[model samples]
Target: MQIIELNQLTKTYGGARGITDLSFTVEHGEIFGFIGPNGAGKSTTIRTMLGLIYPTSGSAKIFGKDCIAHGPEIKMEIGYLPSEVFYYDNMRVKDLLHYSASFYKKDCSKRIKELAEIMELDLSKKMDDLSLGNKKKVGIVQGLLHKPKLIILDEPTSGLDPLMQQRFFELLEEENRKGATILFSSHILSEVQRLCNRVAIIKEGRLMALEKISALKENTYKKFKLETLTKVDASSFAIPGVTEWTADERTISFLFKGNINDVMKKIAEMELINIWVEEPDLEEIFMHYYVKEDGSRHEHVSA
Candidate 1:
C-alpha cells in the first residue's frame, strides 16, 4: 500500500525558494530516499508532508488522509529525526527517551534498551554533557524506541562515527524487516544508495529525478582508464554518452556509454599495456542529476 503520496506538490516561498510541482509516493515497508543538495526543497517538502508548513498549491496525503487536515493522526505513527537535534539540556538520555515514549500507547522500554545497546549510547549521561555524536545517538534511540510505523529521517547519520553509522544501518534494516516504511532525506548519496531501494532527487526546489538505484546504475555511463603500450589520441572517441577525457602520453581516462565490447575491441587493436574500468559511484550519479549547467532534472529509471 502507498503510505504517503504527494500530488503535484508546490510550496513556493515569498522569494520562490521552495519545492515546485513535486510528486512522489512512499509505499508500505519500503525505504524511500529524498536526496538533494543544501538549499534544495527536500526539507520544505518533508515539512509540508508533516503539515508543519502548508503547501502554496497541491496536496499531500498520508495513509489516504489529507496531511494538512489530519496531521495529528498521521504523526502518531511517524518517527521523525530532523537535521538538527534539540532537547532539554538537563534531561538525561533515559529520561528523554521515557518522555518521548509517553506520547505513544505502546511499551517502549525493551526497544529503548535494545537501541541503546546497538548504538552504544549511555542512557545515564545528561544531554548537556554529551558530545554532538552522542547526542545524535540519543536522538536515534528516541526515534526508534517507539517503533513507529513510518520513519522520516533527515540527515540521520550526520554526526555518527563510522562504526555507529554502520550500526544505524543495521538498525534500519531490522526496522525494515519488521515492516516499517522509511522516508529518509539526505545529501549523502552513499547512505541513500545503501539504504534506499528507490530515490527521488531534488534540486533548487525542483524534483530532478526519481528511480530505483539499480536502474540508475544500469542507465548511467561508466568510466574507463587505460595505459597503452603506444601513444594514442582518444579525443576522436568522444560521443554523446561519453564525457570528459584526459590524456597524458600513453595513458588516457574517459567516460563512455553503451556496450564496452566495441570500445574494448577498438582499444585492443591499439598497443595497450594495461586498462581499468571504474563504475561511477552514487556521488557521481547524484552530481550528474543535480549539477547540470542547464539545471534540468532527469527522470531516473529503477534498477
Candidate 2:
C-alpha cells in the first residue's frame, strides 16, 4: 500500500522556492529516506504532507486521502519528531508525555513507561533543566507513546551521542518489525545508507535520484586512485565514464562509473607503484548529482 504520496507538490514563499514539482511515494512497511542538506525542501515537503502548510500548487495525500481535507484523521495515525523540539519550560517530562498521549484517545501510560525506560529518560526532570539531547529524547517518547503506524522523523539524531543514536536505530528497527512505515529525513548520508531500504534524494526542492540503497551503491561511481612509477599523463586516465579527474606528478585519481574491467585492462598496461580502487560512499555518490563534469558545483536556488 502507498502510505504517503506527493504528486507535483510545490510550495513557495512569495518569490522564493520551497519545492518545485516534487513527486514520490512511501510504501507500506518500508523505511524511506528523504535525503537533502539544509534548505533543500525536506522540511517543506514533510510539512505539506502533514498539512501544516498549504501547498502553493499541486497536492499531497496521506493514507489515500487528500492531506488538507482529511488532516485530522490522517494525523491520528502518524508519529512525528521535528528537527528541533520545544516545550513549556515549567512542564515536567512525564506530564508533557501524558498530555501528548491524551490526544490519541487511548491509554498510553504503559507504553510511555516502557519507552522512557528504554530511552533512559528521567521523567521527573522539568523541561527547563534538560539538555538538548534529553529534550530530543522526550520528543521520541512523545511521538511513540501511542504506537502510531506511520513514523516521520526529521533529522532525529542531531543531539544524540553515538551510543544513544545506536539505541534509537535499534528501537526503530523493532518498530518496523512490528509493522510501522518510517519516513526518515536527514542530511546524514551514513545514517540513511545504514537504515533505509531506498532513498529519494532532494536538491533545491526537486527530486534528484530515487533507487534502492544496494543498487545505488553498486551501480554508482567508483573511486580510483593510481600511482605510477613516473609522471602520469592526464590522457592516460581520460577514458569515458570518468569525472572529476585530477593528477599530481605520479598520482592520478577520478570517479569512474563504467565497467571495472575497462579500468583494470588500462591498469594492466601501466607501470604503477601503487593503486587503490574503492566504492564511493553514500555522501560521495550523493554529491555526484550536484557536480558537473568540469568538477564545479551547480548553483542552487536557495529555499
Candidate 3:
C-alpha cells in the first residue's frame, strides 16, 4: 500500500522556492530515502508532509487521509527524530520520555526501558548533563517507545558514535521487520546506500529521480582510473561529468556520470600507460543525480 502520497505538492514563500510540483509515494513497510544537498527543499517537503507548514498549492496524504486535516490522527502512528534534539534542560531523561509518551495515552514504560538499554542512554541523568550523542539517544528512545508504524528521521545520526550508529541501524531493521515503514533523510550517502530500498531525490523542491536501489547500482555510473608515463594536471581531466576525483603525479582516478563519449574523448587525448574503467560503488552513484547531464553542479539554495 502507498503509505504516503504527495500530489503536485507545491509550497512557496512570497517569492522564494519551497517545493514545486513535488509528487511521490512511499510504500508501506519500506525504507524510503529522501536525499538532496543542502537547500534542496528536503526539509520543506517534510514539513509540508507533516502539516507543520501549509502548502500553497497541491496536497499530501498519510494513510490515505489529508495530511493537514488529519495531522493529529496521523502523527499518533509516527515516530519522528529531528536533526537537532532540544528539551527542557532541568528534566530527567526518564521524565522526558514519559512526558513524550503521555500523548499516546498508553503505558510505554517497558518499551522505553527496552529502547534505553539498546541505545545505552542513562535515564537517571538530567537532560542538560547529557552529551550531544546521549541527547540523540534520548530522542531515539522517545521516538520508538510508542512503536509507531511509521518512522521519520532527519539526520538522526549527526552526533552518534560509530558503535551507536550500528546498534541504531539494527534497531531500525528490527522495527521494519515488525511492519514499520521508515522515511529516512540524510546527507550520508553510505547510510542511505545500506538502509534504503528506494530513493527519491529532489532539487530546489522538485523531484529529480526516484529509483530502486538495485537499478541505481546498475545505472550509468562508472569509475575511471588512469596511469600515465608523465605527470598531468588533475584539473585537465575535470570533465563536465566528473565530480569526485583524486589525482597524483602520474595517476588520475575519478567517477563519471555523464555521456561516455565526453570522457572517452578527453582520455583519448591523453598519453596513458594503463586505463581502468569499471562500475563504481553504490554510494558514488548517489552523486550522479546532483549533477546535470551537462556537467554543471547543482547550486545549493536555502529552504
Candidate 4:
C-alpha cells in the first residue's frame, strides 16, 4: 500500500524556481530516502506534503486523503523532525516532551522514556543550556514519542555524533518493523544508501530518478581505475555504454556500463600495475544530475 503520493507537484517562488512537476510514492512500512544536493527541492517537496506550503500546481496525498484539504487529519498520524531544531529556551527537556505529547490523543510517556534512554538524552537540562546535539535529541524524542504511523525526517542526524546516529537508525528500523512508513531526507549518501529500501533522487526541485536500492546498484555504471606500467592511449578503448573518461599520464579512470568480462579482457592486454572497480557513491551520482558546466543546472529532473 502506498502511504504517501505526490503527483505532478510543482512549486514556484517569486524567482521562478522550486520543485517542478515532481511525482513519487512511498509504500507502507518502508523507509523512503529523499536525496539530493543542497538547494534541491527536497525541503520544498516535504513542506508541500506537510501543508506548510501550498503548491503552485498539482496535488499531494497522504493515506488516500488530499493533503491540503485533510492536513489536520493526516497530521494526527504523522510525526515530523525538521532540519533545524527550535524550542522554548526557558523550557526543560522533560517539560517540552510533556507539552508535545499533550497534543496527541494517547499517552506517550512509556515511548518517550524508551526513546530518551536510547538517545541518551538528559531531560532535566533547560533548552537554553543544552548543546546543539542535545537540542536535536530532544526533537528526535518528541517525533518518535507519539508512535505515529508516518514519520518524516529532514536531515535528522545533523547534530548527532556517530554513536547517536547509529542508535537513531536502529530506532527508525524498529519503527518500520512496527508498520510505520518513513520519508527521510538527507545529503548523507552512505546513510541513505544503507538505510533506505527505495530512494528518489531530486535535483533543482525535480525528481531525477526513483529506484530500489538493489536495482540501482545492479544496473548503474561502475568506475574503473587503472594504473598502467607503461603509457597507454585510453581513448582507443572507448565503447558504446562507457561514459565519462579521464586519463592522466599512466593513470586512467572512467565509468563503464557494459559487460564486465569484455572490459576486463581489454584491460588485461595492457601492462597494468594496479586496477580497481568500484560503484559510484550516491553523492557522486547526485553531482552528475545537478552540477552544470557553466555553474548552472544542466539536467532538470521532472517533478
Model 1, span 1-303: residue lDDT tens: 999999999988798678888888889999999987778878888899999999999999998899999999889988988888988999889999998999998789998999999999999989999999998998888887878899999889888999999999989998999999999998877688789999888777777778897865566667788888867775566445666678888898877766777677777677778888876654565566435578654543332
- By lDDT rank, best first, the candidates go 2, 4, 3, 1
- Clashes counted in candidate 3 amount to 0
RMSD of 2: 4.9
Model 3 agreement with the true structure over 1-303: per-residue lDDT tens digits: 999999999999989988998888999999999876677788888888988999999999999999999999999999989878999999999999999999999999999999999998999999999999999999999889999999999889989999999999999999999999999997666688789999887766777778787665555577888998898886777677686788888988888877889999999998999999986553455456456789875542221
State candidate 1's TM-score: 0.82
Give the runs in model 1 whose Cα sits over 4 Å from its true position.
221-241, 246-303
Per TM-score, the best of the predicted structures is 1
- After the best TM-score superposition of candidate 1, give how far the Cα of residue 89 lies from its true spot, in angstroms: 2.0
TM-score of each prediction: 0.82, 0.81, 0.81, 0.81
Give the worst 10-residue stretch by lDDT in candidate 3: 294-303
Tens digit of per-residue lDDT, candidate 4, span 1-303: 889999999999988799999888898988999988888889889999999999999999999999999999999999999999898999999889989999887888888888999999988889999999999999999998988999999999998999999999999999999999999998777788789999888877877778787765565667889999887775778666566778888998888766788888888888989999886765566554345667665443322
Better of 1 and 2 by TM-score: 1
Error of 1 at 265 (Å): 9.6
Clashing pairs in 4: 20-303, 21-303, 22-303
